[model samples]
Target: MTAGRVVLIRAVNVGGAKLPMARLREIAAELGAADVSTYIASGNLLCTPPDDPDAFDRALEQAISDEFGYFREVISRTPAELSQALTDYPFGEAPSGHIYFLTGEPSAEAASDFCSRDFGNGERLQVIGRDLHIDYPAGAGTTKITAAGIAKGLGVTGTGRNLRTTAKLIELAE
Candidate 1:
């Protein structure tokens, strides 16, 4: 059976880094990724990865850097893992929330420390495994819990998807 995975590319098509979705899809296909499809323009990709997930991740990263000269972090998660993250989300029903999936496991202490930090404006955060659920009652645009801040606090790399995008990605994975 082909193993499907979601790949999130960070810092792409933003600032001066231009990674067009069409080029990304073509590159993935050339790298032997099957059924490659991209969601939106923020670098969310769904595909059947090569046999080795770790090797594929590294090769994809290298290919992007080599091809586009844009060295952004790439994070991947299986559909099952993303589904569990959605199931385990603790904030009941939040209309405005984001899920940040980490590339590496953060230390328990780091997670706890990050959770305990005060990110005012009705911001709530919960860390489960490598997934961090953040609800911003005051809107994420104005919130202080940015990707850079999260990486700095947790000592890990991650890419975030808003609730709607998260749900859509899950659906596409299925």
Candidate 2:
């Protein structure tokens, strides 16, 4: 049976790195991903994986790099994971926020150390599993805590999605 998943593509369609959403969907379909759909222009895909989730992730990542010549980090999450993430949000109401999913698992000490550090500019962080929930009241664009910064601080690479986008992706996955 096919399972639903959300594929998060890192660092594409920005800063002159363009990967069209239509092309992305096509690639997923070519890789036997059924019910392929995209959320925004930022490479969020909702698809039914024909194989194991991890294998599909690696294949999709490889296909994108081979066809588009852009090596982007691709991560996938099941619908259940997305639901749990929403339930685990650890901040007060915010004007804007993002959820960053780490590419690699971080040690408990590393996660704690990263969360303990001050990311000033009114940014709050919490590590839940490999996911980091951050709230930036002012705006994420101006925050000192960026994807790269989080990676450096926690020793794990990650890709982030705005709260709205993330919610929509979960809805689509469902």
Candidate 3:
């Protein structure tokens, strides 16, 4: 019995760690998730579990440690929860692969500070409610623009993936 959770794992491929995603699905299976699926090589998992997300988190963490011999920070959100983050994004779909970081709700003061800062690459930042929607028309792998800089301005810890990752997450949730 799989837990109903959307799990996002980070730093899997760092330093050529060889953290096979197939093993990740197997770990989810051991955690008692029934309908287990992985979104991409970036380490996103959509699973239906027998227990609630809290239990799944613990079990999955332990399983991953035992299997991989390392600890990974696992963030789990329900599809509905992530859907709200997507809805709050303000950009009107400018580029196909625009990346946005879904971070903690920035304080009103922090948001105000970010409104005035420039990203050095002529990039634009918008805060729609709690979510930070960044229009990176230049795409990732560029030296000038970065999601981290935007997160720093907003005072939150998060990462952004391409638009392809966003669409797949939505599709898996559906």
Candidate 4:
């Protein structure tokens, strides 16, 4: 049996987001989630949320906003879905990349526009459903395609976690 969903909160513990993991777990528990846990300080939450996971995602987002005085998108995925992302990774085990978990899959036109846009060399982008896979060989710090750029191009909300961290979250969720 799978553990549950991996709830990822966008841009936490960085740039003054400051969401404490212990408090996060407490919030989830208050919301009736079971087996609540968190990974790292970057807002990776693991739990079997109450009722619908999507609903839980939204509730968590709201709760965080209410309690922490800031808003952040909370995106969740089942263990199977997380595993599928690993399998669907287009870089084929290149070992370094990130998966941007979108609120919903972008439209074909948006995906095409984002794909066609020149973000500079050594950066490969592949849009897979709600996941945007990006591989920037020279390191993300040097990439022209940024989080803001992605949001603008895709016209959607999302949060990104690196490939290794994603694998770790999957392991923890299972």
Candidate 5:
């Protein structure tokens, strides 16, 4: 019994991965999702998935790939999960930061090794469950830390949402 899910598609509307939000919402509706909507234009989709959340995620991924010619990973979490992840945010309150929703929990060794690296001053990150909390004091756009760097460190792919977007997603989902 899922209430709703926040669907995050990695790195859309940036670089070359162009995904129209309208098309995304349309595809989701075609897949039988209910309450279909999108936030901003960066591929943040909110909907009650048509079937099993996992299956819905994969199918949406496939649909987008088939339509757009790029295969970006789709990560989904319930409103409760998002709220809990927020509660677990380790960096306290900061003006600029992001929560990278990883594809899966990193292995113990990978997590440990990643944490051991010094990501530089005014920059911090922690692997909390499947969410990587990152604080970018310098700013998100210019920060040395990146989703690819985190993926390499943790051995799992992910998409990032700024703290504001994360909070808004939770609010909208609820």
Candidate 6:
């Protein structure tokens, strides 16, 4: 009964706090949604909703918090949006050495400063659209760039997942 596309939520598997994929489906169902499915353990959800999206978003956030007894920030991404994010990675490096920092908003200016400071030489980064692709070919050698550093530099909080994980998420979204 859902109209429009699926909503992909990020960062529900951090800090030893786990949100079961089944519960996610139930939350969506509580909001009058159906055909709910989850991908992997990183809180990716594909659901069919039967209500206003904005309202559904808020309701889901509250429901998740109430069920988990804690609060988590949820960002929604459509299937097309996920596909475009995957396509934005234009690096000629090994997939393992690269990671995509999923941001809730575009931080091109901030990302520029991030690339300069946190990243060492030859480490390229691009803030294309709403996604930030960071390629570290040297395997963090001589570079202390961590997920926290990138998140702080970009002025946003995000979970950094490897290229393989990104691909899997994209596949699930599709």
What lDDT score belongs to each candidate, Candidate 1 first?
Answer: 0.86, 0.83, 0.66, 0.88, 0.88, 0.66
- Per residue, candidate 6 scores C-alpha lDDT tens digits across 1-174 of 322544655567777668998888888887887667876778766765676665776688788888887766555566666667667777754554454445456466786777666344567777765576777666644556665776677887555556776666666655
Q: Write the per-residue lDDT of candidate 5 for residues 22-49, one digit (tens) a residue.
A: 9999999999999988999998999999
Question: Residue 173: error of model 3 in Å?
Answer: 2.4
lDDT of 3 by residue, 1-95 (tens): 23366777655767564577888888888777878888777768888877777678678767777877786656677777667666655566657
Model 1, residue 10: C-alpha shift (Å): 1.3
Q: lDDT of model 5 at residue 155?
A: 96
**Prediction 5 global C-alpha lDDT:** 0.88
TM-score of each: 0.94, 0.93, 0.74, 0.95, 0.94, 0.76
Stronger candidate by TM-score (1 vs 6): 1
Stretches off by above 4 angstroms in model 4 are: none
Reference-based lDDT, residue 55, model 2: 88
**Cα deviation in Å at residue 123, candidate 3?**
2.2
Q: Write the per-residue lDDT of candidate 2 for residues 62-149, one digit (tens) a residue.
A: 9988987878888989888877887788885565877898887788898888888876777788898989988888788777776777
- TM-score (C-alpha) between model 3 and the true structure: 0.74
Candidate 1 regions with alpha-carbon error over 4 angstroms: 1-3
**Lowest lDDT 10-mer window, candidate 3?**
94-103
Q: Candidate 2, which ten residues in sequence have the lowest lDDT sum?
A: 86-95
lDDT of 4 by residue, 18-100 (tens): 99999999999999999898999999999998799888998999999999899999989998887898789898776568888
Query: Across residues 93-165, which tens digit of lDDT does each residue of candidate 1 receive?
Result: 7888888989888898999999888888878888999988888899988788878888999999798888788
Which regions of candidate 3 are displaced past 4 Å?
1-3, 58-66, 69-71, 96-103, 127-130, 143-155
Off by over 4 Å in 2: 1-3
